[model samples]
Target: MRAVRFEGVGRIAVQELEKPAPGSGDLVVRVEASGICGTDRHILRGEFSSRPPVTLGHEFSGIVEAIGPGVTRFKVGHRVTGDPNIACGLCPSCRAGHVNLCESLEAIGVTRDGGLAEYVLVPEKQALSLPADLPPLYGAFCEPLACSIHGVDIAGLRPGMSAIVLGGGVIGMLVVQLARLAGATRTVMITRQAAKRQLAEQLGATASADPSAGDAVFDICGPGGLLSGGADVVFECAGVPDTVALAPKLARRGGAAVILGVLRPQDRVEIAPLELLLREVRLLTSFLNPFTHARAADLIATGAIDVAPLVTRQIGLEEAPGVISEPPPAGEIRAIVVP
Candidate 1:
């Protein structure tokens, strides 16, 4: 099998490797499509500290090539994607239904070989059957969509509420759509890129703002500002320190602030805890999706959110190494590696 592997920090290469046979209770998937995620970039830069020689594309979908002993729910040829977060089911977090926060967790593409290969091994229990009619590319998005959904759930969005999404990349755009579908009366999107703002409007954002043009996002979204004082919810999805720093001021009194991005180490963003207490503002963080992969698949299959707009490019496995080293063009989002 041909796989894209992280040779070391600042290095990645596509090489032929032995196709893994499913371990007991495991399943082997024939890779069809694997999307590159921002985490893949961190891993390459030594921020994620993944083991070397590990295959690193996690967002994906494919066919069940084989199943291990005792695997009964699916058979060979069944179309599937999987839960990439490997958790210890008996952990305190997992027992509390917060598997995303499990102390003992290993992720596909991070801690183990992932889908950027012709065939990859996954736990059978982690495999999810895709909607028969959904395209493979769309299936590849289930992971990220699920993560976005989890954030929405944490946001506690109410019907007729106003929301401000602080980014326009794939996750940010997805959050904008989810906010709309989740019943936000006004979902305003902000980004430095004009193209991203346009895409946001097309995806149902009630308004769009250019934060780079000397326009203050916090002031515009919050009290006594452009949109006339604060939104019901403000989602920090850009993963930028500056944007995360602006979150508290963008949310209304008693509103919720949801952090959806993985901030880099040494990046500091401060919030006034005393101010939050006075305003009754809620602060929350969504790490990853837990038990929501099925719902994301349903959303995509039913045309609830169009993912085609987010897929900026698709490359072969061999091109995966270079992409990790140097990202795509500005405003280009969600590049998939077709294995």
Candidate 2:
């Protein structure tokens, strides 16, 4: 088996390694498709926290090649998507039902061998069943979609409400669809890429704006602007300082601003306390998928969310290292690795 391993900061390679066998209560999945994520780049640049000398793919899905003892919920031939994030059940956060905030969280691909190889071991608790007929590539999106679902849930969007999604990457694109499904009647997407802006509109964004054209905040939230008095909910999915700072400002008075983006560990942004205080805006942040993986799988399997448009390209495991080592191509939403 060949796995894409992150040896250290600024180092990555696809090296041949022994295939994994399922441990007790684990499943050995033959990697079918894995999606390259921005976090992969962050980890390569040493911006995100990750244990090196491990496989680097968290958003993946595959066919079960073998099952370990006591794994009765899934069979050897089932198609499944792995949640990747594992929380200690005894942790305080887990006991309170906030598993994503576990005091000691261990994630696949980040801390353990992941699905970037020909085969990866997945604990039975982290594997969720997917439809056997679901497209292999689509299954790879379940992980990201699950994270987006958590963001949407935090937003608390309501019927006929307005939403502004910053950044038109895969997360933003998926957030747009989720907002609409959550009953957001007016959805606006802001991004520098014209191609992504166009795709967002096609994917249910009521409108799109170019952040580089001018002051995006005024253009979308100004009086008589797209949403007039700002959106009911604003989602910062770009994971950058500029978008993070602008997210709360795009929310209407008393509305909520949810930060779904993951920034570099050392990154920081300044916000106006007076402005937030005067407007009474709720500033919130959403982390990893806590308990939404199953719903995400159901949405993808039932064709409720359109993931086909989000897949920009596909590459082999041999080429994954290069893709992860370099910046994403212009307007590339997602690059799927077909192992």
Candidate 3:
């Protein structure tokens, strides 16, 4: 099997490797579609923590080729999406039902062999069933949507409330749809890309803005602005320092600012504690998906969320390394690798 391996920092390539077999309580998934994520680029640049010399794809879905002993829930030929984050059940956080914050978290593609290859191993518990008739490419979106679900949950959006989503990337785009579904009446997307802004509006954003404009933020949140007195909730999905810093400022007094973006580990941003204090804004952060993968699969299967527009490119495993090596092109969302 050919796999895209993260050799080390600044190094990644397609390497031929032996196909894997399922272990006890595991299943072997024949890679059908894997999405190239910003995290993949961060891992390649050594900005994100990962185990090198391992396959580098976490957002993927495939057909079950084989099942190991103790795996009774699924059978071969089932279409499934794998939840990459594996948490130790005995950990303190897990015991408290905070599995995503497990003391020791191991992730597929990051710390283990993942679905970037012709075959990848997935534990039965981490796999969620997808509709057999669903598009192979759509299954890859379950992972990211699950993560976005967590972000929305943290935001606590309510009916008729307004939301501001920073960055028009895949996460932002998905959040826009989820916000509308969550009953947010006014949803705005802010990004520098004109194409992504247009797409966001089509997906569900009530409006979109170019953050590069000097008065963009003020124009939307200022008195008598688009969203006068700011939004009820602000989501920072760009994973950039500027957006991180902008999140709280965009939230209305007593509203919440949820950081759904994953910035480089060493990255830091300055925030005005006094302003947040005076406004009583709740600054919160959302991590990986926890107990949300199944809901995401159901949403995708039912066509409740539009994922077809999110897929910006499709390439073979051979091209996976190159796509992750370079920054995403303008207006690009997700690039799926069809193995």
Listed in order, each prediction's TM-score against the native is: 0.95, 0.98, 0.99
Which stretches of candidate 3 lie above 4 Å from their native place?
Answer: none
Q: Which rank order by TM-score, best down to worst?
A: 3, 2, 1
lDDT of 2 by residue, 1-339 (tens): 999999999999999999997889999999899999999999999998889899999999999999999999999899999999999989888999999999899999998988899999999999999999888999999999999999998888889999999998899999999988988889999999999999999999999998888776576788778798899999999999999998888899999899999899888999999999999999999999999999999999999999999999999999999999898989999999999
Q: What lDDT tens digits, residue by residue, belong to model 3 across residues 1-339?
A: 999999999999999998897789999999899999999999999999898889999999999999999999999999999999999989889999999999899999999989888998999999999999999999999999999999999888889999999999899999999999999999999999999999999999999888888898768999888899999999999999999999999999999999999999888999989999999999999999999999999999999999999999899999998899999998899999999
Ranking by lDDT: 3, 2, 1
Clashing pairs in 3: none
- Against the hidden true structure, what lDDT does model 2 obtain? 0.93
The stretch of ten residues in a row with the least summed lDDT in candidate 3 is 209-218
Question: Which stretches in model 2 have alpha-carbon errors above 4 Å?
Answer: none
Question: Which of candidates 1 and 3 is the stronger one according to TM-score?
Answer: 3
* C-alpha positional error of residue 314 in candidate 1 after TM-score superposition, expressed in Å: 1.0
Best by the lDDT measure:
3
lDDT of each: 0.86, 0.93, 0.94
Candidate 1 per-residue lDDT, tens place, 1-339, comes to: 999998889988898899899878999999989998888998898877588879987798999998899898888988898889988989899999989888888889888899989998989888888866677888889899999999999888979888999988889989998988989888889898899999999999988888877756655754566456688888999887888877777778889889998777778887788988988888889988988888888888788988989999989998888888886579887898888
